[model samples]
Target: MAKKVIETSKAVAIAAKLCRPSVIAAYPITPQTHIVERIADFVYDRDMDSEFLDVESEHSALSACLGAQAAGARTFTATASQGLALMHEILFVTSGMRLPVVMAIVNRALSAPINIWGDHSDSIASRDSGWMQFYVESAQEALDRIIMAYRIAENKDILLPAMVCLDGFTLSHVFEPVDIPEQKEVDKFLPSYSPLYRLDPKKPISMGPIGFPNSFMEFKYQQQEAMQKSISLIKKTHEEFSNIFNRSYGNGLIEEFMTKDADYAVMAMGTITATARHVVEELRKKGKKVGLIKVKTFRPFPEEDIIKAASKLKAIAVLDRDISFGQHGALFSDIRSALQNKDIIINNFIVGLGGRDVTSDHIKTAFDKTIKAKQTITEWLF
Candidate 1:
């Protein structure tokens, strides 16, 4: 296996090649441009047997993907902030149809005033649209999660769309060394996709049609069951991926560092966890008991796992890069819910909004505050 320094765009392209999508419907946007561009180049060069549908807008891109997936073709697409907002309506439709479409969302700040920098607002806004969302902290995680997402989403028990997110310029444009597996290995890991139900003229079936009140609830109930069932499928996929790649993602719910005997823990998502881990190491060296928890999956919320990890600690600090507005951070509310009825002290800190820098010192500051507060606080605004 050879290693090469590659940009996030190339890494994603390589991953797509591994997944072997049959159809790619995408429109170009800044920060997200290279990913689709590289894939298009791959298609142009006949390196992969796939259709690259160049649509006029994000709406059309998703719409095309929906049709392709409905026709029993493995589908993929890429988008950013404004583009994602444009596809908001179709996003719900994809989930409602239960089409296992895998998309790469280069996390970007949404606009009242147009901006292209990274933020979670774009994807978080559509959290309720029935899509399984996974936030990646690095280029490697982004690549790995895409492969895992396809397997998870297409599982017979969980036929739902999935969004794999990476920060706009931070991980997307930054160059890093990545290990890309061989095509044969990827093929062995991810075989050709076979949809349970698809639109076919020979055996036609209607999809995404309006259901009356009589059966609407049943459809929704099944969707919920599928989502609930995804938890186990997610775990199974991680195990299989570990067996093939020789690297384990550690349960696919949360990754904990030095939490076994720690009294204080910091919780975060995406790349910010990397900084938190460094601060935790420093605190440990100073004889302070501290740990870090990185949340990889956000949609399912992983309530039980969160409770199990944070319950034993005296104090837990949640650092959210995203804001829910009028409430605490998004993860803050969920952590509180997970700790309900349990005797545990939790603090919520909202930082790194609009792509602000969240340094190790900031994490250390939060940890110090948590230790000093010592169960006398509920939430601290950082």
Candidate 2:
């Protein structure tokens, strides 16, 4: 293993390279372009041997990956904001078809005014698309999750697509010292893609055909079953990866920091969790009973883990980077559902929309409000 101070995009590209995907198709999008560019470097230098497709659009990129993965090849792709929105239709197709395609989402805000900056709107908007969503807080987690996404998604019981999301510009453009696992170690952890089923001419089987009314609901039911099954598979895969790599993130779902004895806590995902962690520490030093909950996996919701983490706390603040429009924050809604029957106060704070910086002061304010909140409070922290 080697540790290097490199851009988060570079770390993602290198991690994808180490996994040795046979096919890569991605369109250039702001912030996300760097990841594909670095992978192109690997293909150009012959450091990585893969079929790097120069696709025309984000839709085409994921389409190409879907075809490749369906034909028994491990595939990868990436995008952000509009690029992800463009691939919306295919996103459902890829997941519903049960292709284990992996994607990196440099999370960014969707357009109305055409702004391009960091936010969870892109991925959060696709929450119901049947893809296993993994959110990371740093370059290192981004690197590791890409490798783990493969094993978890490609599991025999869970042949579903997965996307690893990281905040754009915030974490993607920043440079940090990350430990890159050796290729052999990664290979040992993640063996080459041996799909149980494939689009082989010899087999000549049909897949993803139109589901009739008789079977449409059944197909949807199966997808839900696999999603539920994946919760355990994700945890197991995380444990196996940590055993070999000696690194982990709170059991590969939700990480609770300093929440053991705290009376109140802050809950959030992505890079903002880092700032929240700092604020929690500062509040701790001041003898405030506060903690932080960092969510690593968004999809499959981690409801039980969330409930367990929020238990015993007097009140909890849920910070979200995306709003559901006319409703509370996207994540806050989920948090409320998880703790709906509990006796604790749950407050929602929507911050960092459309790339606005989420400073520590903003996080401190969420904690301060949460600790003293008497009932459910929703506030915009812009």
Candidate 3:
């Protein structure tokens, strides 16, 4: 692998080329538009070889990917926010059919208030869509996740579609130094995808067929089993990746920063966690026992690690970019529920919605309040 400074979107395009997907269907929206644009340039310039289709809509993009994957081919697609919402219906079918299609979703806040900025709302809202999710911190992480995602999703034991989400603009538009793996090395890391079953005329099989009341619940249970089973496989895949490429993130589940010996900790997802890390260091120097835990894999939820981390801390501040109206922040709710029996205060802070800048000061304030907080509740941070 060679290190190169490139824009995040361009890095994704480079990753696509290395993975050698058989088919890539795309319908681009804000932030993610550059991702498909770079792919188009690669296919147009003939630097990469793949069937890149500019489908009319996001739903069509995912639908086309399903067809390709079901036909026994490695497939990929990308979208964000509204575009992802558009394809919401077909997302379940993709996973329900057990197609290992990988997608790059530039996480952006959903609308009603009309936002085109980075937020977890876009992906968090689709948490139950049955797709394994990864929230990356930087462009380099984005590129790495893409390569690793294929291996995890296409594994025989876990045949579920996976999504690699980078914050809209924050991680997408910003440039970062990424170590680009060579084609041969990537090929060695990820073997050619082999499907258990295919849409071959010789062997006709009914897939995603109607399940009777008794049988329908079984299908859902299988999906749940695959997701839960993926926990270890994901860890193993990340370990393998580290062995081959010398890169790994948070044991393939959760990444902890300065949380080993601390009385209070902060938990957050996406790019904001980076800022919180810095704030933790500053608080450490001031004699405060502050730590950070960044949720890297969200769909499987990493419940075990989170519970263990919160067990030692007196309190935790769950900084979320997305809010669940009437309830609490999505991340906060999941974490609170996991730590329900624990005797610790967990404060949910909704910050940086609609592209707001989540600076060090905002994170510092959250930490200050969290370590001193007495009650468990959700609060909006401005």
Candidate 4:
């Protein structure tokens, strides 16, 4: 398989070709348009054996996905921002039913003032909805993670829906060189999805029905247990993918760059980590001890990995693309809770909201501020 430089749209089409979903339900929205448009073209060209459903609204898009998935078909969908908010109700239902539907969220800032640029608000709003979310920093990861998502979601121990998210426009519309595997290779890599349970007329089984409080609590408990079990299954799936693709995804939970012997570390997610890495390298050149921890998987939270990575550091800076009003950065709160016992100083920086550019210089400045604060303060926010 020869590597080729292709637009993000083409990369998604290539992923669709590999996944071979039986049903694709989506409502067009900016930034996310390229994904579904390419998939629709594949369906029209007869290159993919899937039903392209033009849903009336995002709510119906996910609702249709839920129905198709319950019928034991491989299902897929894509949405962003307001579109995702519209499907919020169905999102929870899909997870509770354990349908294992895979969705790609082009992470977009939510609106009251109407903005379509990148942010984590849309996905973070549904963080506790039982769906496993993976944030990708590049187009290659976006395509590759979707494949891994299906494998992890369909695991019998973790029959949960999964969301593979990428920053809108940043990776969605950017052109990059991606090595799209041959169809034969993809088929061998991802076998036919076999659901552990499905709605069959021959053997009628209840799904998504009204459960009383007594049984409902147990069902919720099972969902939590499944999420915990998915942590290991996610690692196993990544290993299998690496074996077949000859490309390792490091640790699927987190990717650390230059953090081995650093006194300060910056934690971030999505494409911002790419910028942070450059800043870390520049600081290292100047004899400044700095490193980065890029979080790839957000749902399971990767608490243990984060603590171990930040423990040796004298100070840590958390850069968040989303804010949690009245407090600090959304990820900052989570990181703080994870490191409460540790003696390391932590700083929170909220940036890149509503598509603000988070340049490498911005990251370097944050690091400088964090290191200075470490000399006297307990905690700092930039």
Candidate 5:
């Protein structure tokens, strides 16, 4: 293993390189472009041997990965806000075909106003796109999760695509000291892409065929069943990875920080979780019972783990960087669904949308409001 200070984007690129994907296809977009660029360097310098496709757009990028992955090759791609939005339809296609293609998402704000700053809106908007989403707070976690994502996504029980999300510019552009494990160790942890099935000329199998009404429901049902089964697979893979690499991210799901005995907790994803962690520490120093819950895995929602973590808390302040138009924040809605019929007060605090900075002060206010709230509340932290 070697430690080097590097940008999260480079860390992600190195991680993808270590995995030795057979095909790399991605179009350039801000924040996320660096990741693809670094990977291209690896391919061009012969440090990595892969079929690097210079795709025309984000849609082709994902579509190329889908084809490569279906053909029994390990595939990868990366994109930001509008790029991810463009790949929306194929996102379902990749997942529906049960191809285990992994993509790194540098989360940026969606268009309309056209902001390129960091936020969770991009990935959050794709929540139902059938990809397993893992958000990271730091470059190290970004590198580590990319490796782990491959293991989880390729698992026989969970042959689904995975998205490793890091805040654009926040984590993506920032530099940090990251310990990159040797490729040999990574190989041991992640053997290879032994696909359950592949498009072989010898076999001549029909793939992605039209699902008639009767077959269509079954196909989707199977996807849901696999998704539910992934919950345990994710935990097991996380444990195995931690044991092997001596690094982990809270059972590969919801990471609780000082929440066991707290009266109130701030639940958040991405870099904001880091901000909340510090605020939680400061609040504790001031004798306040505020803690933090860092959600590492957003998809397959970690509902049971979240419920268990919130059980002892009096209230929870769910800080969502993305808000559903004319409704509650996506994370808030899911948190409420998980804790339904419970007595604990859950407040939804919408913050950091369109790349607005979520400072420690914002987190502190959310915590204070959560503790003082008599009932569930929804407010924007502007």
Candidate 6:
């Protein structure tokens, strides 16, 4: 392993290069631009060998990735808020086709107010794209998750696309020391792409054929079952990753920080969870039993892991960086569903939308309110 101080975007590109995917199709958009640029540099410098396609737009970028993966090539791409929105339609197509294309998303706010800063509005909105989603906490996890994404996506039983989301600017542009594994070790962890199905002349098999009312539900059910089964593979891949690299995040799902015996805890994803960790430490010094839960995997939702985390707490505060119009925060909504019909008190706090900064004090205030607040209450944090 080689340790180097670098921005998360650069780490993403480096990790993708190390994975040695057969093809990479991507277009540049802020925060996410640097990652693709670095990958291009590796190709230019002859450090990485892969088919790199610089498409016209985000939609075409993912479209190319889907095409490449369907042709039996392991593919990768990167995008952010507006770019992701443009590719929304193709996102479902990629997943529905059961192509295991891995993409890196730098989470940013949706435009209209014309903000370029960081938030979870982008990836959180794409949660229903039928792709396995992972929220990273730091540059190291960003690099590690990209590697794990490939393994998880290409799992024989789970052939769905995967997304590795890093907070735009917050984690993507932020510089930190990261220990990157060698290509040899990564090769051991993630073997070459041997897809179960592909489009080729020798193998005359039909894919995405016409699905009438009779076959449509069965196809949808197959996708659902694959996603449900991915939960175990996600955990298994994380364990295998840790066993080989000696690094992991809470069994590849919900990472609990001081939540075992706490009276109240905060649940969040991305870098905000890292900030809440500090707030948890400070609040503990003051004799307040506050904790933090960092969600690593979002899709397969980690419902059971979260229930276990909230089992001992008096209350759990869910901090969401994305707001659902006319309703509560997105992460908060998911947590409530996970702990449904239970007598658990879960408070919802919406903070850090459109790149607004969320300081440690703000997180501490949320914890204080959650410790005493009841369920069914949602508050906006400034």
What does candidate 2's lDDT look like per residue over 192-285, in tens digits?
9999888988889887899999999999999999999999998999999899989889989999899999999999999999998988899999
| Clash count, predicted structure 1 | 0
Off by over 4 Å in 4: 375-382
* Tens-digit lDDT string for candidate 6 (287-310): 987888888898979898888888
How much does candidate 6 score in TM-score? Answer: 0.98
RMSD for all candidates, in order, please.
Answer: 1.5, 0.7, 1.0, 1.8, 0.8, 0.9
Per-prediction backbone clash count: 0, 0, 0, 0, 0, 0
What TM-score would candidate 3 get against the native? 0.98
Model 5 global lDDT (CA atoms, 0 to 1): 0.92
Better of 2 and 3 by lDDT: 2
Cα lDDT tens digits, model 3, 1-382, are 7898899999988887889898999987998999999999988998877899899999999999999999898988899999999999999999999899999999888987888898889998899999999999988889989999999999998999999999999889998899998899999999988899988899998777898998888999999999999999988999999998888888988988888789888898889988888888898999988899889999888899888877998999999999888988998999999999999999999999989999998888888888778898677888
lDDT of 2 at 6: 99
lDDT for residue 375 in candidate 6, whole number 0-100: 55
Better of 1 and 2 by lDDT: 2
lDDT of each: 0.86, 0.93, 0.90, 0.87, 0.92, 0.90
TM-scores for candidates 1 onward, in order:
0.96, 0.99, 0.98, 0.97, 0.99, 0.98
- Cα error, residue 137 of model 2, in Å, equals 0.8
Best by lDDT: 2
Cα error of candidate 5 at position 224, Å: 0.5
Clashing pairs in 5: none
Candidate 6: Cα lDDT at 327: 88
Model 3 regions more than 4 Å off: none
In model 1, the clashing pairs are none
- Candidate 2 clashes: the total is 0
